[model samples]
Target chain A: MNLLLLEDADFVAADRAILRDRRLHHLQEVHRAQAGDTLRVGRLDGAMGQGELLRLDAGEAELRLTLDRPPPAKLPLTLLLALPRPKMLRRVLQTVAAMGVPRLVLLNSYRVEKSFWQTPFLEPAAIREQLVLGLEQARDTRLPEVLIEPRFKPFVEDRLPALAAGSLGLLGHPGEHPPCPRAVEGPVTLAIGPEGGWIPYEVEKLAAAGLAPVQLGERILRVETAVTALLARLF
Target chain B: MNLLLLEDADFVAADRAILRDRRLHHLQEVHRAQAGDTLRVGRLDGAMGQGELLRLDAGEAELRLTLDRPPPAKLPLTLLLALPRPKMLRRVLQTVAAMGVPRLVLLNSYRVEKSFWQTPFLEPAAIREQLVLGLEQARDTRLPEVLIEPRFKPFVEDRLPALAAGSLGLLGHPGEHPPCPRAVEGPVTLAIGPEGGWIPYEVEKLAAAGLAPVQLGERILRVETAVTALLARLF
Candidate 1:
């Protein structure tokens, strides 16, 4: 954990917090932290600063916080991803949050297996757990909002156009299309497909919704890699 | 498996190949491939083409190969990465290959755990297995050349200088450095540090070897994500 993230419940006072959970384990084992050691810390959705370890023990560790700095700015992005397989979803969530995506939409595609929607990983608390890990990895405090869309057509046709209206809507598909733009000027609404990619009809539907198709060469990257690649290339 | 990768041992004749291993199971289970099916296939380190499934049984599957197209071109880059923890090493190997990095150097770093170098994943066969999976994912036919450097100073000071001589040598570090360059022409030599980042002395040694330090903003990304992000941005 790069930053010691403190939730409101962990606070005993405005400046004092107690860590009794995995964070304590991390501090004890991974960090091998001791009393008087200063650690980088942040409040969930709040400011980041330093915390001086006041007390260290097996049960819990006490810290005095001075959260002052704001979290890093999130990407000007609303990512629309075709829900990956359950195993991949967890990693993608962590990747998205770590990369500073402000909003993510896990939408349905023809190629997405129906069983994927049943995965426990999509549960709010489970999703939050992965996002928190990402936050800890990146040393950020803010959490990205995640939205689920089980119906592809309704989401694309009814809600997507308005949501994508002001953004540079893009579809990350491998094809005979223009390369994905570099260092884009403003907000982007990018849709990435499932393993086999979006079907031709679905691609047309997305295109009608203002997400023009773009290519990232011939090599087909895994969804997680593709997400990082597209975001990196775009911004 | 996007492309059915065929090794030399799989060949029964000049044009016919039999699959009885994991590939056969993959064809039966994942692809649900049947007799008379035409699948995208690639010969290891050779060509890519269509394979007509002549026979399909529980024990074995037979294919008639018609190799034609050349594999996708590799990037004009050589990547140097501090060896990651074993679990991540497998995924990073796959990512490195999938992204078309023709050469990779797994180098030692101050922050790298001593146990990381002892992983069975570092074994030649184990490494090749991951690389093959990457090639299959990306539909590429060639495996990336992976070199291990257990001694950091000698590799960087004596050998890296010559290896990176004509290329644009860059280091992916997080600090008060210029942003990583985008869309550069010709070859590049990139060095990415380990989890806690390169120590000051190691950075200086690398600098003397021609790799100037560059940053990727404030957010700290995992090594795998950083690799993808850097490659995507640079290329």
Candidate 2:
């Protein structure tokens, strides 16, 4: 873990926090940390700063905190992604959070298998676990909000237009379309499709919702790679 | 598999091929392909074209190949990456190939675990397996050249200078360096460090070898994500 993330419940006092879970294990094993060692730390949805280890034990570790710095700024984008397979969903969650996406909408596409929705990985706590890992990887504090949309049509037709109204709505599909824009000026609403990509009718629906189609050349990247590539290219 | 990759051994006649392996199973299970189905196919390190399924059975499938189109062009870049942990190595190999990197050097770094060098994933056949999967995913027909450099100092000081002579040699390090350049013309030689990053002395050695250090903001990304992000931003 790059930063020792602290939840409110971990606090023993205003300035002292105890870690007794996996963080304690990481500190003992991965870090080989000792008392008096200073480590980077952040409060969940709060500030980031340093913590000086006051005590270290097999059971728990106590730290004196001085959280001051704000977390890194999130991307000015709302990502609308086709829910990937269960295996891919976990990695994508981590990737999305690591990349500093502020909000995510996991919407269904025709190609998304119905069975994917039943995966335990989609559970709120499970999703939060992956997001925490991403935050730990990136040393950030705030968690990105994730919204699930099982019905594509209602969400796209009734709500998407308003959500995309002030942003540059772009669809990441492989086709005869303009290349994805680079270093975009403002907020973007980007919709990426499933493995086989958005069907023609779905593409048309998205277009009507203001997400114009764009391509990233001929080579088809896996969903995780594509997410990273597109975010990197865009901002 | 997006493209049915055919090796020379699979070819029967000048314009025909047979599949009895995982490809046949994939055709039967994933694609649910039948005789008379026209599928995209590519020759290993050769042309991409359409294959007309002539026969399909549990044991084998036969196809009539009509090879024509050239594979997607590779990037004008050579990547020098510190060897990641074995699990990440497999995914990074696929990402490297899928993103069209022409060459990759999996070099050792100070922070790289000694056990990482002993992974069976580093074996030629194992490496080739991942690369082939990448090519299949991206629908490309060529494999990237992967070189292993177990000793860091000697490789950087003795050989990297000449290797990086004409290209825009850049190092992906996190520090007070310039932001990574975008949309550059011509060839590039990029060196990405390991998880904890390159030590100071190693960074200096790489600098002397003609690579200038560049940063990708404050957020630390995993090795695989960093690779995708840097490649996408650069080219």
Candidate 3:
């Protein structure tokens, strides 16, 4: 548990901030927090502080906190990824968020199988859960904005331009090309393919749209690996 | 398992191969293979083959195999990484092998916590097990060789020139002035950092030893991400 994040309303009471359900569960199970114990806590849109557990019970807990300052400014990076397998999608979202990319655009691609779109795991709440895990890992309070585009053409032709504005855009593919640039200034937009990878036509289209076809090397990486690798090198 | 991996000894008799233990468990549980099922199989140092289940039972299973052609060539690159956290290490080794980087050098780095060296997962057999998963994922039978360097300085200075022979050696770091190149030919040796990333002095020593400090981008990626990203762009 990096930081215990709470909502604005949850922090409203002056006497003691009472956490009854999820927070209490976290305290007991994840943190193994006890009475008089201090856990790293953060308020919504507020600074990070320690929460002193004044009292604890099976169901609820009361904490006395001292909020100080907010988290580090998040990097201005947008990840444009093809929707992956359901379980993998969750990992990707959480991992991306944890890495400090503020925005994620889950787009469509050619190699993406048809069944992926039908998964119930695509629900916004499920995606949120993954994002929350990401936030917890990085100790960041701000939730990254996630956008889904089931249609490939519309996303790339219409929405991607504005998002790529003032950004260094790069596409990851495995080929004998230049390595993906390091230290790109301004906002950055990175495109990664699906399991089987972006077909030649799709690569051409992306290249025509100003996304450079850059590679890390000759090895073919999984989707999750490619995304994480791009963020690591670019950020 | 993406690809069913078999060994020369696995081909017991002229026409029959008996699969028992873990492979049988996977065939039963994961693949749900029944009698008459055919699976893609690879022979160690031999060729990709087809396995036809001739009989099945709790004790062992009999398979009729048809050996054909060699597995795909491994990716034309090599990787040298700082030993990451054990949890991340499993994924790193697995993914690297899956991508077909035939060799791995797990070196020590400045940000690599001292305690990490104590992990039981660092054992050769344990590390090779993880690489097997990657090989299975890629459907390739040849296992990647793994090397360990518990000490950082001596390895980078003494053994680097020989290991890096005929191969471009690059170090992936976040802070260095310029960015890393995207793609290059011939064999390559890539050195990545741990979770906390590479300390400056460590990067300089490698750079002075004919290694190039390549940047992925402005964002700091986790060690796992950095390795994959550098491999994608550099190899």
Name the top lDDT candidate.
1
Number of the candidate with higher lDDT, 1 or 3: 1
- lDDT at residue A171 of model 3 (Cα atoms): 87
The global C-alpha lDDT for each of the candidates, from Candidate 1 onward, is 0.97, 0.96, 0.77
Model 3 interface CAPRI class: incorrect
What local lDDT score does residue A45 receive in model 3, on the 0 to 100 scale? 48
Residue pairs in collision within model 1: none
lDDT of 1 by residue, A1-235 (tens): 8898999999999999999999999999999999999999999999999999999998999999999899999999999999999999999999999999999999999999999999999999999999999999998999999999999999999999999999999999998999999999999999999999999999999999999999999999999999999999999
Cα deviation in Å at residue A72, candidate 2? 0.4
| Model 1 agreement with the true structure over B68-155: per-residue lDDT tens digits | 9999999999999999999999999999999999999999999999999999999999999999999999999999999999999999
Model 1, position A139: C-alpha lDDT score: 89
Please give, for residues A119-233, the per-residue lDDT of candidate 2 as tens digits: 9999999999999999999999999999999999999999999999999999999989999999999999999999999999899999999999998899999999999999999
Per-prediction DockQ:
0.95, 0.93, 0.23
Q: Could you tell me how far off, in angstroms, the CA of residue A67 lies in candidate 2 after the best superposition?
A: 0.3
Candidate 1, which segments miss by more than 4 Å at Cα? none
lDDT tens digits by residue: candidate 2, B1-235:
8999999999999899999999999999999999999999999999999999999999999999999999999999989999999999999999999999989999999999999999999999999999999999999999999999999998999989988989999999998999999999999999999999999999999999999999989999999999999999998
Every candidate's fraction of true contacts kept comes to 0.95, 0.89, 0.28
